[model samples]
Target chain A: MAQKPLQFRLNGAEKAVFVEDGANLLDVLRRSVGDLTAKRGCAQGGCGACTVLIDGVPGLSCLTLAETVEGRSVATAGGLPGDGSHPLQEAFMAHFAAQCGFCTPGMLMAATALLESTPHPDRDQVVHALSGNICRCTGYEPIIAAVLEVAGEGGGGRS
Target chain B: MTIHRGRGFASINYPIGMNLGGDPSQALVHSSPDGKFAIALSSIDLGQGMKSVTRQIAAETLGVPVEDVYVDTADSDTGPHCMGSFASRGTHRVGNAVIVAAKEARAIMLEAAAEELEVNADDLETDGRGNIHLRGAPDRSITTGDACQAAQFRHGKTVAGRGIFLIPLSEVEPETGEMTPVSCYAHAALVADVMVDDETGEVTVEQVNSAYEVGRAINPRLVEQQLVGGAWMGLSHALYETTEPRYPDRSHGPVDFSQYTMPGPGDIARHDIAILERPAPDGPFGGKGPGEMCANPIMPAIANAVFNAVGVRVTALPITPEKVLRGLKANGGARPGPRR
Candidate 1:
């Protein structure tokens, strides 16, 4: 294992780091770049806790090779405003969507991709979009309601 | 070839806390010169809103605003002794300790205000808006911050209190194998509606309705979160989750999330919850623990639902499709149980 240099736009800022060959994007982002928001839940892509936006599409960072993200835009939950002013963050707080918050970053990344692509996704669409993400807390109900609230759809009343 | 729909019901009376040895939780309440309160404890939150609910309890007991209170749960070495946060004892046990500590600290705070106002401490009352006032006189008052400052700087008194809650261990009768297990109990009833595909043996949970009698909800939203998430976990354990599908040969246990199966967001059922509050006398603000027991009733309810749908009684966990199919075959096809 030799280490190589990888450069990419992370959260709208150019980030350059040296990563070992076969290293995953999650490890690089967490260990090398010091961005610890993207959690390594399963590390096998089955649990989407390490989800990140690769060029506006949600991808599991644990499954992504570091070098493959070279020169590409990698968006993480850290990309959201730190002031807790992001609409998703506000909605999550208002709806009590997070508990322990280990899966929150990935859920936010996945929802970010969905809202960016389809601004007004329906309840089923939200469920399908978040199907890949797993939350052991909150039962995915409040999370769905939070996203729906941001999309101007009120809680939608139990579908 | 047909999908059979059936409903089943299950109820449970769950104990609140473990009575192993002696279950105890300790809390320390102290105030700064600025009147901001901090509660120190060793109980871990574990994503169940332990800190938030305890803060609410402390604020209520101290007669102060919630925003002025903060909870610090340092490690065991730094904080007070706790029986840990398992057995759903965080709310019932730890909250009682916080209440005692906050009451002691509030007494000292009122005493200091009484000294400054030249009135009897018994005649002073907290307005819960950060002010200590005379019981009958509305205009005669002093801010809690000023009271704290007077207590610390002028009176040279520390506005702090220590509290510990303990349920003495119940001695077991060796001959009878009997013992008092817990202090209080929470009750729940759940009805699961499921669809079983007779041909494929796949079970889909269509809807779930549950009612919980949690001795008073300290925070209703947190209780709701626990109920919803616990039911999902129950459903997962009922139909999908298993580490050893091929038991007795422990060769291929799941090493990752891919092998370990759980219900995804798409597999979630429509759940409706009704919370019934019956305050426990020994509970803090009449609140009991609602963490672990919320998931208990759903597992048996789902198992019963599968039995009602296909007349297959699955005694083992996960109730896998293969087991359902085998049970159906043994019973000579899908024998739907009589509807209740």
Candidate 2:
């Protein structure tokens, strides 16, 4: 595969990178862009660890070709916190929402896409949106709570 | 090692004699003096809350918060050599060790408090933040950090908490192929309702109604999170989880990440999680393990739900569309079920 020069909007900053024709966005983001926030749990799209945003929509970067991301606005977990701060990220830490912190970035980004589109998702909707992301810990309660916090639910008020 | 061989004690039925929930498990908790803690856990947080629990135990022991304490939940190297993180040992053994270490530190602080306030050692209390004072006189108090500093300056760091947790060893001998219940185990029951695609075998878990006896809830939110994650993991194992072999399964399973099925954010339905706070005698806070509990029952529960919904029983996991179709065909090749 031949290397190609690709340009895209990352987080909110426009960036350019060169990668082989068949390289995945995951590799490009991790190696080329130096964004380690997007993890590599399963190279396949099955894990949701590599979930990202392609034009504000949730997507799995591991299975997506780098070529597909050209001229598109890309978002990683790192990108979600435009001001280096997001309520979802705060709720995650306040609620002990992260364990290894490896899955934290990925999980936050995935949920960001969901909450951004639907601000007040019901419990069922919350589960459906998070179905693709696997959190071996926290089951789904606190994560749901964190998302619910954004919608003015009982998240930070922990006993 | 009592393997009762009567009617119910036979291979499948032999829970007959000895004990139902005797010991906690193989690796429990062992504590030392200061606040050094270790846990030999049958349970793991796997990014859940074990680490926090460990820290909580250490800090709470002497009336401190999490930031003032540090605990190592899992150890691949020389742990305080703790066990693997699988069950819910964070509150069990690890918490107990913190109790022990904190108690030790508390004794010293109590004696000091008694001398300073002219009260009984027991009459004194270490506030939730490690500051020692008389029961009612919050005015007469001393910080644990100060105490430690004083102690370190004089006697050199006393009452360090250390623990070794061994779960009930259910070691199945490779030679005999037998399961030996090393310690008492943790159990959970879940009731799940799901919607399935009759044509695609695609199933959506709508709700999970479950109750677990994990001894205690050191951090209720964290436990709930574990349950949610565990439930999803269970769903994956039952329906979609796959390890694309070093190569591929002889069963013609797909090798592509997109093709290899696993639970993702899109596949889950809403959940109703209920945590049962039944304190296990063997558990730390009476907390039994819930790490793998939710996962094991998910697939089984889904299969049962499918049976209740229609009239098809698919023994195999995941109950994919193809399996449902085949099962439907096998059952008189008809759309099997009593569709209301």
Scored by Cα lDDT, where does model 1 land?
0.91
Off by more than 4 A, model 2: A1-25, A44-48, A51-75, A79-85, A93-103, A110-159, B1-45, B73-75, B87-90, B105-123, B135-139, B157-159, B165-185, B194-204, B242-251, B333-340
lDDT of 1 by residue, B1-340 (tens): 9999889899999998988888999999999999999999999988899999999999989988999999999788999999998888999999999998999999999999999999999999887889989999968899999999999999999999899999889989999989988889999999999999999999999999999999989999999999998888888888988888455476777767777886678888999999999999999999997888988899999999999998999999888889999999999999998876
Best by TM-score: 1
Error of model 2, residue A122, in angstroms? 7.7
* Candidate 1 off by > 4 Å: A153-159
Lowest summed lDDT window (length 10), candidate 1 chain B? B245-254
Q: TM-scores of the models, in the given order?
A: 0.97, 0.72
Best by lDDT: 1
The structural similarity of chain B in model 2 to the true chain B, as TM-score, is: 0.74
DockQ of model 1 vs. true complex: 0.70
Cand. 2 Cα-lDDT = 0.62
The DockQ-based CAPRI class assigned to model 1 is: medium
lDDT at residue B1 of model 1 (Cα atoms): 98
